[model samples]
Target: MKCINNEFLSADTYKLLKLAKAKAKDINYKYAWVHKGMVYMKKNDDSSKIIIRIEDDPTCMSSNLKFLSLNVNSYTAHTASFELLVTETKPHIISVVETWLNPEISVSLNDYSAIRRDRGFTDESGRYVRGGGVLCFIHKSLKSKVLFISESNHINHPEFIIADVTLSTGSHMLISCIYRRPQGDLLDKFFLEFGKLYPHYNNVLIMGDLNCNLLKSDRASNHLKSFIDDSALFCVPFGSTFHTLETDSWLDVIILVSKDKLVNFSKSKPPFIDGHDFLICEYKLGSQNHYNKVVKFRDFRNCNHQALSQTLNERLRLTDIDPEMIDLDELVYFFLYQVTTSLNIYAPMSERKICRPKCPWITRELKLEFHERDALYKRYKRTGCQNLFSLYKIKRKELKIKLMKVRNDYLKSFLENESNGSNIWTKLRRVGIVKSKQSSPLDHFDADQLNKFYANILKKHLSCSRDFILNLPHLYSKKVNFEFNWSKIDIVDVTKNLQLTLQKSSGKNPDRLDLKWLKDHIPQVSLFLNLIFNRSLETGSFPEAWKSTKVMILGSNRKLKSLANIVLPQIIIDGNLIPYVNTTKHLGVHLSANLSWDFHISQFLRRLFTEEDPEIRRSDRLAAKNNISFKMPNFATTTYEHSFVVTAIRLWKDLPPEIVNVLSLETFKVKLFDFLISNE
Candidate 1:
């Protein structure tokens, strides 16, 4: 084999080569090469590049019960590094202090959802502002709610935000992120509000940059100590020894409800340049599952498609029978059974492990530099040598530069791709925005009230009156009659409709039957369905089993809780005023009373309105106004309404006044669907 030549290799590769050479000498070989974690050698010398690619298994240190807190003086400066650590570590929760960020600034975390409280300003022009800010990021998988402290209105407290976290252990905990300035005026107010709020929450954690050195016997430290003692809180005193900066004074603190509550706690030095050390704390939430269940999916790419097709055709041909002998329902069952059995024999599904890429920017070169910096950091910590610290800082800076280059390049390429064709707006939505059915986190005290609220709304919307229908004009009747399709229901049409519906199936049915079965026996299944549907239409009734329906509740904003009080529990559906549900999917569309769509729109508008770049928002408005045609990529075509902007625009543009203002909900739905189909 021909081989390329190289004069030198990377330091890591050189080290690996030396080790391989030493091993080869011991094994009575002239040369060796390490490939796929195994050594290979040739008797004859051959010059080569000696390039080896070693793929590291990116570790994701996620847990159902993990919390992290850090005080980076200027988070914007080190956000990339922080995000790198966060993505790899996958902490359940993170609290950041001294973010020095403004409301207009966007901080994106792919795996975590963040809420921020920037330092309040006093000027009308909004030009003058303070530097300190607090931001919190909770893993997207966790159930968390952003809370606004009511007392902030009455008293001037420091920048802080409270979050209600539902632990995997089934217990709810409240976490507060506080950033107190050294000025000390708001310090007193912070304590007062915290003391008042403490009574309301059972388990609590308050962490931030307090700017008070506990080691000093001074009044500020002593006062904080007294407050902690009185409030029945425990302070993790690593603060006294773990210096936050080169100043060699500890100012950061992690306060908990009690000392015994913390199952695991440790402070570690981060490789990145930062003021405060990273603190990881795990609370013992009794009986909570910390690890997520590993979900594997079948690798269908390797399926025997030719064999499956042959088996499916054979099975379908064998099942042919006289139409009169077997009814449509029986034919469907038989066809499905055959197709399903064929699939099992030829293309059975299996579970396989999945490996997700954690950090795309972590190249081998950057990894080596990071490891070097980390080693220097450890040596510095152990020996307390200023030289090691300096060397660590140099490597850290170089690593940061490399990280920035990789991030910027990736972002540049991403923006270019996203901007190509119709992806500009679509990919922007994917950045940090999520559209979901909004539901408020409800306490047991208010659960009944919230359920009743949804039950009332659904009842009001779904219920119809005979009198109201009778009052409609004869012209309306003519419109409805004209709109109806009078085409005769036949075997061919029924078969075609069934085929189309099966193609659209999302594979979420309770029955194990899949699309392959229906596709394989379309002729038989279609004939069967046509007969069944025709009979049902002629009889003016559907089977009771087919007539059954499901209801989904949308979550609303907490501020709308008072609206629930107006809804009495008189309305009953499914034998309950309101059925118990977390979230429900109906006809493939997720629904909730909070109707997260409304909340999503509000959030979208909030960001849109506050956006510093007027051009971006202006373009969005223009796009909406012009009713621009947004062609979705093939992959994205499955679900196009992933963002509030896209969804709101589509709904608004399609539903004209005639359709939207229709008095009858049934009519509105019919017209709305027609409009959507025509547009599509």
Candidate 2:
């Protein structure tokens, strides 16, 4: 067991080494290693070499020897009152041994061990003596040989000790030891004396029992606050050193370093203890060879209260004893599961109902029956489809029905009382009706009187505008396609040759179609075209192939002619066209045009003769001549009219032999027109 424990500790140490290396690489620092009692050094790509052995007294020799041997380094055992030497050329690791004689006599390396020693002074009664002291070691590389020490003697205050040392390389280290008063007025005097002596050193660490919790503020806490305010010194991270077991207060402190000089330092939680707790302050020295490390808990065996509790909990969890026969904590765990399951089973279906059943005795009996049913179901291996699940589902449905019945009964009661003043008004308000005042005899009117009053009001405001009446015929006639002279055509461009061919062959004038007409009629054409394209896009049929059979573009209107031009190109460009053409036909023509044009023109013309506006009347006369002069020629009569009507008719006609023999419409139309005119 001891060997296994040692192996575990070694594994932990290896993990720490890996963590340190990762941290060093992240921060761009050069060297990092574990420092046993014997120091190890590696410089400039060379293997590690043993540099020095820190001497430990007889008290710490056993653990120190074990640590050094496990780490595989050589060390010389010695006892001396001198400090170790560290240089700036490469990173150096130092290990120190010190005795701890506090609430418990434990190793100084353990973070939870409190080093308590008394001062020479005695209390007023002389029954108790103050003679406790703490031993601290300073680790740093210095430049000079001589060390400076300062002490303060203040009234009713603990003495303040400050030490400054410079090594052979001229780098410096300063250490401050403060012994504070146990109680009363002496604490204030100690802080004032310490403040007076603080400013003279750089790279200082003030560590000792100051008898104050820096983590919290209290009436007695002002002394530490004042000391920090007056001195240039600052506390490091992991600020709390002493933790009270009873109150869980962090009282005793070890403040270290002038804040600006210390860098790359982190803290960890103090170890658990029975009576008192302690924190460790770990830091590095120098600018270039700064160490990356931890100030962690070392010996924590003395505090066993929390540890014992944890052990007890674990034992209880693993034991086979019945929960009902066990202690309160174990019983709580068992009962909580029962209550959670019961609540989950009922809560969803009981929205506004009381949690308890309407009849208390029934609820108790039902609960007892449920337990029996659950036990039987579990025994039968029918946990899912058996008694408990079926009962829960039935209970939910019954509760929903009860709730609905209550709601319907309440609404029925409200509607029955509807004749009283309040009830009548309320009923009217509910149905969104407003009540008016009762009329006097003089204000009463018969049907004839009402009709005459309405007529007078209507005649007073009614006046027809000339444009509204006279323009009605043109608006109405606009819906019907009247033939126009094909000679009036202009703005023809061959770049849109397909569109031009479709328009000319259909005998529709493209120049007369404006943007407004196109905007209004395009959607209808687009919708039909979308239906045709959707089929082609899905079935892999070309738009022109569909156009040959299912869809037909037949209209004398110029807008409809322009729409055919617009939709055909859009279909080809969007890749919705099918490759093969179907010569056989299936469907009749689907007309895409405005139905509103049929009615609007007739209404405007009827309003013209009765309208009052003279200016509108004159404009109406001009629009009628210019817009309505186009006549619809009879296809069966005159030869010119026959040619014009034939052009419109041929769009829907089957290809004849003469037309099929021609290469293009220009070739066919020129020959047909000469033949028709010469024969006439």
Candidate 3:
């Protein structure tokens, strides 16, 4: 039997191992069941009546308030690894520096909402200075509100992102994620900015990769020390060596005010996604949010469908129908109530935990490989052996390859299963596979420029010209060959069609209603839609809500516009000419005005648009020429692969001709998009 020492294991694993060893001895067992880095030793042979209890380990306990900070050199390559760590660790808040994220590439995680201040702001010359960004990821359950900071107030602006947090305990915490470049006078300016903000928050946490070596008693270090002294901030001592990388110097640091407010401050091994180690801390500031399990009356696999139909029929018979007409809203509400009540009576409510599932791709082999890689890294760090370091690097590369394979396998299986009609959508909702965006380079225009550009677009495309509108009556009187029957649109058929087209799980619409809720109450919604259509036909007018238009801006060379102007002679939304953007999402396929795929490429090659960055280009050249052994940033790697165009075309080709040819443009846009996106 092989014996593993506690030195190589994590604190939690060590405690579990000790308990397992004792239990195995008590049961006189020669071996223990080891699976996925956990030891499952039976206490007795009678498995059914076995005594199962272990002492509570503080290291294994979940923290009410947890924070993780990492100096990710570039987040593009390591987003999957970072998400895995965050999911497993279950941190409440995460701070990342040197993110190198841009508007084109989205790094948003499922359970986490991102607040990113990316680098590469274009100057007057339309050139970019690309390399420093700060970002933060807060769990959606935290209910954290980000406070906007005015960057113009500071004369010397260092890269930083600050957020004011109101914890569950009702305590206030100010978190600042910063990145200080090791250049001229920037560190001094950072210290000044820090001093100015330190006095504002009572419980402040300052985390960053401040490139100054604290071990060296230099002027910058001394100044940092002076600021720490003045601000009454306590710099937590690293439990291990201060160095995070192979440089033998410490760069990453964490400083916080109020020692009593924090606990369990420690550093993790290098995550292998980046060169820097992850700093983890837990602060008991506020009460934990009470996650009350919502009781939903969902149909189970063995639900009595026959009984449900019979009960609904009997209930409908019991109701006395009036000969006179009722209000449209009342009729719709009563129909929904009947359907919902019948379903609830047939299928009782069940309490399900609102927990995100683990990544389906994370296999036991992957866990063992990750553990082995971390062990090798620790050994190399301890012994400083060239051979050990070489082996570690090899293992690191192999681990990356393994991760890519697992992700690819997962994606392949997911798409295949979903295409063949599988209930894998529930898991897909929790861990949606993030794909790199594929499109042409967006335009670089300021807010004023974009407003002007979109105003013109709206006028040309959306609004009718004066001459065209004046001639509309003449054209309208000349009836076309097309004819329609409003009565043929059965309410039940429309309801079923809408329900079939809905996404399994997605965010709320502008009306603040989820697809699932709409599906369950589709009859009422369909009746309401029927009433609205009839009313529109009778009065030749649409509802105010239906008239509101939300514009989505896409295409090449687009800037991050705050607001778009729309001024037309005949356009009005909600009794106003200037309509606001209701909802904006970043994902689409581009087509020319003539509906030709001429400009669109099959592959979303990230390298195509990024070739202009000198830093990235230079790094890639150096790595190729010298066969660099160190970890390269995301930009240095030339392995960008995406088959979005191929998959999309294949899916579209698979659709039946009858369905494809008959679907209207608006219907295809909403329903086809939902189907493709949900499957993806």
Off by over 4 Å in 1: 1-293, 317-336, 355-415, 418-451, 457-483, 488-680
Worst 10 residues of 2 by lDDT: 65-74
Ranking, lDDT, top scorer first: 1, 3, 2
Clashes of each: 17, 33, 8
TM-score of 3: 0.32
For candidate 2, write residues 532-637 as lDDT tens digits.
Answer: 3333323222322213122222222442433433534211212223121212111112211210101011111223223445323333343364463443322212
Better of 1 and 2 by TM-score: 1
TM-score per prediction, in order, is 0.34, 0.25, 0.32
- Judged by TM-score, which candidate is best? 1
RMSD of each: 21.6, 39.5, 26.1
Q: What does candidate 1's lDDT look like per residue over 530-639, in tens digits?
A: 65566445433333223223223332344234335544223243234444432311112123333232111122222322435532342234333444433222222222
Global lDDT scores for all candidate models: 0.58, 0.36, 0.56
In model 3, state the lDDT of residue 110.
Answer: 73
